[model samples]
Target: MNSLELGAIGNCSIAALIDGAGTLVWGCFPRMDGDAVFSALLNDARTAHDPRAHDPREGTFSLELVDQLHSDQSYLANSAILRTTLYDHHGGVVEITDFAPRFALYERIYRPPMIVRRIRPVKGRPRLTVRVRPRFDNGGIRPEITRGSNHIRYVSPAQTLRLTTNAPISYLIEERPFLLDRPVDLLLGSDESLQAGIETTARDLFERTWDHWRSWVRSLSIPFEWQDAVIRAAITLKVCNFEETGAIVAALTTSVPEAPETERNWDYRFCWLRDAYFVIHALNRLGVTRTMEDYLRFINDIVEEATEGELRPVYGIARDTAIEEVVVPHLSGYRGFGPVRVGNQAYLQVQNDVYGSVVLASTHAFFDQRLGYPGGNTLFEQLERLGNRAVALFDKPDAGPWELRTIASVHTFSAVMCWAACDRLSKIANRLGMADRASYWRREADRIHTIICEQAWNPDVGSFVSTFGGRDMDATLLLLHEVDFLSADDPRFAATVDCVARTLKVGDYLYRYVAEDDFGKPKTAFVICVFWYIDALAALGRRQEARELFETVLRQRNALGLLSEDIDPRSGELWGNFPQTYSMVGLINCAVRLSRHWEEAF
Candidate 1:
């Protein structure tokens, strides 16, 4: 059966049944960046026809694969618990459920060796089919599979996987098509045996996972107006987090094109300094100070490990700064989009805004007194040095916030962040009683504010332009309120917000920046930008408008309450990478802001 509409239902049926093989269609394991075991999402042909296909529907197979089954899926309320039900034309019903255990005493820095998947027959005695095809190292290497008494093992140099079955059934491994198919009552762990007192252990582990999530959710103090949305957004953020390092990736998948068939797809599975500050603000407001501390420590470690002139705009989960962009010809892009890319080359581009973003985060940390380590003050000093560097290079042409393929004049957003960094440094130093350096930073902040107001704002349009001496309006300027660069009620701020509402709003969603003047045509609606607009509206006392817009954007969340980097407004389908952290962060912040407003106004 050629099925394409399948999506995550609650914490249930998160697994995808592709073709006839029971290969994990798209899962990142050992960590999010670790090679995919089954990457059919990247290259279906290679996955389906490779020598390692696991097709269970070969001959007299107990499992009957149905392609056209109408399916509906949802998660258990306020939890990542997903459930998907399949209704067949033959009046047979089946349900598949999937979830990873969330809580264990193991250090958050280590990953457990297994993912649990359970399938149950709801109505009829529908014969269950099982296929176990695992492509290791991101489908780049095929492992040697060995059969155990009640389990199967795929062993390779970098990793090992073991699958355990419950019921007795015939198992077969094919060579040309590279597949393994079997009929089994239950499919269990890949590396360990489940028959010798392992099933109970697995079930207990699953329960603990659910309990961990529940405890975390219950601890949230979200107000009534946004309880449900905030919970979902918070959980989605947790999913994007690399538990081991406390660093959160911007998105799950890589190379989902921003503009279809174009080379605009970039890997977003790294932590951006720009996201760190807002992340702290959101988590802290929600009373999740631990995550905030983790992020602060991660940032400090990055700074400590850095050599002079070696600060990067972003880094991998493990703090690696090497992300060279490359296209994989082997895999056909999503929905026929071509040239699926692996790494992000934007790492090499100069984005002056990162310094400001880091400083903003540090400023928030300082105010909250959540700075984790002894070197927190020293790190702030390093940031001030970077601020000096920013002032020297601020006027030069470089890639802006969008990291456009081509360099341009001084971007208004970059300058605004430069202003924010100096502004934050002054605030932090003064608060810490360092009066000597405070005046220098304050003067620098004043100079940047004046320069941006004079050179970046266009009096003709009464709105801040995207670049110096440019006429285009950018959605990024919405961040003026976020950085305290401009008051939301400021007339100039209102004019800029109105400019964005007129030009950038695509339906209820917003675009990152104007596309005609830059590389690649403008495409999907940037989900996070829409949330930024909602936050700005709320800050301006436009609560009704903000709530309405926030509801509209929330409607675009996927079946599992997940969000991608972009949304196709015309079709309302998720377009960019899956479960983007920035989108979730925006959701949490907007919900918190609007909910507080609702509570007070009511």
Candidate 2:
């Protein structure tokens, strides 16, 4: 069975997930948003329809250690390299080092579209079998294989992959176990010859890559406490960025359901403006401005190319504006459910918060001196266009932050974000020395804030509800203090926090809301909402309770110290897409907020 508790190894462009037993179970080729080359995570349920169907093993790339009794996996400190060790009952041991090479090669970065695996004997005579199977076009078709003297080429309609290995090709093809002798290097990339001896080159690349990652981690301005968790979260978030165009995907995989059998599964490979904005803010706190700058460029391009009327909440990594939804019937869902989906229909919906998200992201360019393109009057005027839209749509109806498909309401969270946009734009205009524009934006923000306080507060419930004139408690109410809409000491804000905690809190986990949507009630806790609850706890002066809650959520990370989008509150099992950007962002934000000051530590 494929383990959802998986380790991920990637180099900015492409990433692959390895099961606890160290088998490559999930990965996409070319880019983070590309087709899954290893689709075994979603098993082939088509076998049930046909007795003579091909074996399902073709979707996975596994390394089978002969007579293996136990396996262990971990990442090298402060780096993306993954090391898995397998031990046989007879005292034989083997180690597998997996990484996608990324370093400063010459004057540029050498993050190739490849996964490198190095296998070596640690003790005794450990024998092994290597199974290499790569599917194409979302696991609907298997690529044709052709062998040469030192390599095997997988030919598909979209692209070609060449596996250059020092291991015996005959043994690999026939699935035969061979005696342990020397180290073997497997280079999986485009059809090309390796420059140096396989083992020598692999060793050099591994060393350089390790050094590069460690250097990058050392440069981050992280909190003194929870250094390990913060570092891992930062690394995972960094790899999720598609560096070429500066687009950061929400998650690497598609169709991983938010809950079992809810059919709530949607492709998360595209960039959501709201999610990316939060991600940038979290990274900015760590003094990691490169990602923020890159993402700004990506969002800027989207803003430039948008059709006249309104902005979308999500966009493709390559900036493909229209993403029509589709379901691939051939492959089963994650863990053999059904309906593996691709593309997101959410792009077509008018999410009013997107204007706020865009303005928030662009606002950073004005204050941060490290950016190449700093904001000024020209940029401030351009951002006024987005602020104008936020003003027009603050009270209008559209899909809110939750993206409910069935109904539309004046969501309190959406309006608060609009208020935030105008509020921040007012500050930016003042900083740029434009007093008139600053006053105008401040006046608009005050108008929106006053109405929200009047309409969104439910007197009978004694709480600020999810939507105007409604009684549903949303976890987003927890963010009211973080966004500066309400002061932490405000009585209404305190009441709302207590109300959301009482209603949405399930054990230590918090659900987005209790109300049923088009699919029915949510069965799992959205991970980020729980983090927001942690932050709210801190803001409410419950520091000890907040610390305990933060540590409790940290325990829910998978074996690789990574988190997904949601978790089963009952079982504590992770659900949703792997290495979710929102979850990682939550980790960073909470750590920075809750950690003791460096001076106190000293």
Candidate 3:
């Protein structure tokens, strides 16, 4: 059956999800939010009852061995490149390497929207069939195919894919099995001619990309424990970043259902201010500031374009604001779950935490000398605009962090983040020696904090609730300590954490909440919530329990040490979008907090 066990590879410009058998099951071409050129990930529903249950609309590119028995896949050492080995019945073996070229060229960073595949025989004679089928418009359109002596083009009116390969064009075009006695190079990219031999060019680009990733990994200041896991998570976050426009997409594949037999899937292709803040916070802990710098620039543009200091929760990579959510009825969803959607509707809702998210994400730029472009008075003024919005909306109700579709409530997290916005701006103003402005922001922050302390806490429940004067527990209350709204030593902070754990814990995972919302009760555990629980554990000096829970969550990662947005607590199977940026960021934060110091290890 098709699962999220697939590996993700990308160049920031574009990304693709490769199944264990070395097939491009899901990917969008031209750009991350563009048309789905390879939509098999959502269309294929091969099940045990009927293995042929998958839709016949071809949307995948596969390199299949005639008698394939099993396949193993892994990302090379510390690079984004993935290696998959398929062994046949007669001891025949094939190795397929996949990556999108991302390295320096022409004195500037060179990253293209492309995919490079190298297929070669490793053992005996391996008979293989190369299938290069691509559909556009979310499987609603099949492009015209035109093949040449060396390259074949899949042209859809909207976009064109050029398969520049060294394999026999006839064998590739016709789904015919052939002998793979030697290595073959396939570079699927824009409709352009190759400047050098396909094999030599691919090899050179592969080496350079490998070197670039290794060098980037080496520059990271990783904790002593869980080095491999941290590196993989870091690279995954880097892959999610749309370097061209500095917007980091939430995930690679969208509309992968959050649970079985449910219509809970939503698109994660756009940049969410709240999600991007978590990503940057984790990277900042590891001293990776370039992503923050780029993302800040992206957010800065959004702030500039905001009319009268109003902003939405999401925006397209190129700063497009009118991101309307649409459901494509053509493609069947993952595991037969339908209602595959694109362009999140959350953009149209009021997620008030975003104001504080922007302030917290940009605060590092003001004080960190390592950044190329540091924040100053001008940036502070722009952030004040968001703080004003926060002050106006903090007490009012809209969609909270979870983005409920119906019935607004005064979410405590939203109110606290608004408090955080003013709090951080106070410090920023103080840093700039604007004492009057600092005192202004300080009073604003204190007013909100006092309100939350009085209204958000419930004496009957013996803990703070999810919303003001509400009685239910929420996982976000665990973050009260992390965000510095409440000290770890505070009894209220400890009580809030204890309350969430008692109410939300299921087996080893923690659910976001128990109450029914627009989609009913949350069935799967939001993976990041578990990480936050771990952080809370550590903050409250529950070291042993924190480490144990961190390890338990680590075991829940997919084979590639990657995580999706949510996981089924009962089965521990991954669901929701693939390579979720929030989940990876959570892994990084927990690993950093739990890892022993290098000196202590020695």
Candidate 4:
């Protein structure tokens, strides 16, 4: 499938074509950061190395797949039960269901590795075909595959994937298929004895994983309007999260370029500091405290580990700080998107706002009492130190939030976040009875706010500019209300909103930052920024307008309700990164904010 088509089936899949190999592509085995068993999407040639590889061009393999199928991909009402349907071209159909069922006995803190893909051939026999191919270590390492009577075991140095099939199937090194009678069950799991004790242990691990996810989902308190979408997004987000650590990756797949055949492809498997606050906020809203605590712990550990005493913009799921961007010339790029990058070089860029973002997220946790008051006090102290560093370097010209190619003057968004850091620090300190430090932080915050209000606002246009001494409007300013830097009802805020709607709004979508009239590429509207616009409207009491804009934005979500980073306004095609965490966070936050506003109005 094309990237757009594959993205469209994100939530609506009985058997999600995760990787190009047609096996479950983007699932965590022992944990989210564990080696991918199916990574054909990254390297098409890797499929040739596997014992089970299928070529669609060959007439021998006739696979019937549906596109844009009508479906509700959601958690099983209140559980993490994922249901997807397969409609055969010949009127035959099947339901492929999966769930980590909640544990029946004492809840295990660590879930065993297993995913249950239950296929019920509802219609005719339909000539069921089954093939299992397993790759190890992100397609970098190969494993020794040993087949038993009904089970297949793939063993590597660090991990093992045991595949058990109920139906008798023939194995092939090339394009081949085996027919099966009766229902078939396949258990893919990790454990040393998976091959020797495949039957009893495999079933046990599958049940345990299901139960763990189910129990976690049951803790959520979702409103009717957004319960399903929120739960699915949350589960996908969680599944992308590294269980070994609390770090969350941007997406499961890498090298899915922003624009097909362009060099915009990036590796999104690493955790970003910018996503830290949103993850915490989302999980906290769902009443999932353990994950949040774990995430905070991960953050603290990284902060303590930093020898330079400053946070990297991104980190590996394994908490490795060193990420060198490298293009794999050996492997053909995804859909011919040249230069498939494996590691993020942006981590090395000096993004000034990240410090403030980290501080802001931690401070939010403290203020909400998500961390116990006394324990929060200790956390606040750490945040205060970070805030102090931000204040010290507030005026420096580092990369802004967009991480643009050219270095510009002080970005208004970075300045605003700096102000937010100080303001949040002052409030937290005062709340915790640290009167001595409160005055200093409060004064610095006021000074920064005054500077931003004076320098960032463009009087000629009556709106906030992207940077100091600039007149181009920025979508990031929509967050002023979110940080409480400006009252939503303020005339200046309204003027800023109007300016953005007029200049940045291309047709129905919103751009991130308007070019300075000389920049080359004509950028598409950022999907997340447009949602932020809706959030701003909601906060300003434009409930009807906000809802209208929100629904309009929601329509941009491909058939499966998945959003990329940006969209081609003219063609209505998704652009930029696929399944962006930023877009999902924006969607969830807007839904929650609008729901609360609607409830208050009622």
Best by lDDT: 3
Name the 10 consecutive residues with the lowest summed lDDT in model 2.
Answer: 44-53
lDDT of 1 by residue, 1-602 (tens): 21222232112112222222223455555566655565665553225554434332221112233532666666666666555566666665666555655564755422354555555667644544455566666666667877766666778888787766554424434322211122123443336555444456556655776777788888877766767778887876766666566677776667666756566677777788777566667777788777776776777777667675346788888888897777766555555455667778778888888778767766666677544443347767777777776677666676888877665669988888888878888888888788977898999889888988999889898899899998987789898887788987799988889898898988878888755645556777888899989988888889999988888888777655667778877877777766677888898888877775544766
RMSD of each: 4.8, 1.6, 1.5, 4.9
Order by lDDT, highest first: 3, 2, 1, 4
Model 1 residue 234 lDDT score: 80
Q: Please provide TM-scores, in order, for all candidate models, with all chains considered together.
A: 0.87, 0.97, 0.98, 0.85
User: 1-602, model 4: which lDDT tens digit per residue?
Assistant: 44543321121111123322123444434544444455445443334554333342221111223332232333344444455555555665555555432343564344446555565566654444454555565555567877777666778887787766564535433324443234445555654334444335435645665666667677776654655667666665565556557787776556766555556677777888877667667767767676677677778887667655577778887788877777766445454444656678878877777777777666656556545422456677677767877787676676777776566568888888888889888888888798988898999999988988898898998898878878877788888888788997788998898898888888878888767422344457778888889988887788899888877877777654667677877788886655677887788877777765436555
Better of 1 and 3 by lDDT: 3
Model 4 CA lDDT for position 483? 77
Which residue segments of model 1 deviate by more than 4 Å? Answer: 1-24, 44-68, 89-91, 106-110, 167-169, 172-196, 369-376, 517-519, 596-602
- Which has the greatest TM-score? 3
lDDT at 93 for candidate 2?
A: 90
Between prediction 3 and prediction 4, which has the larger lDDT?
A: 3
lDDT of each: 0.67, 0.88, 0.91, 0.64
Error of 3 at 183 (Å): 0.4
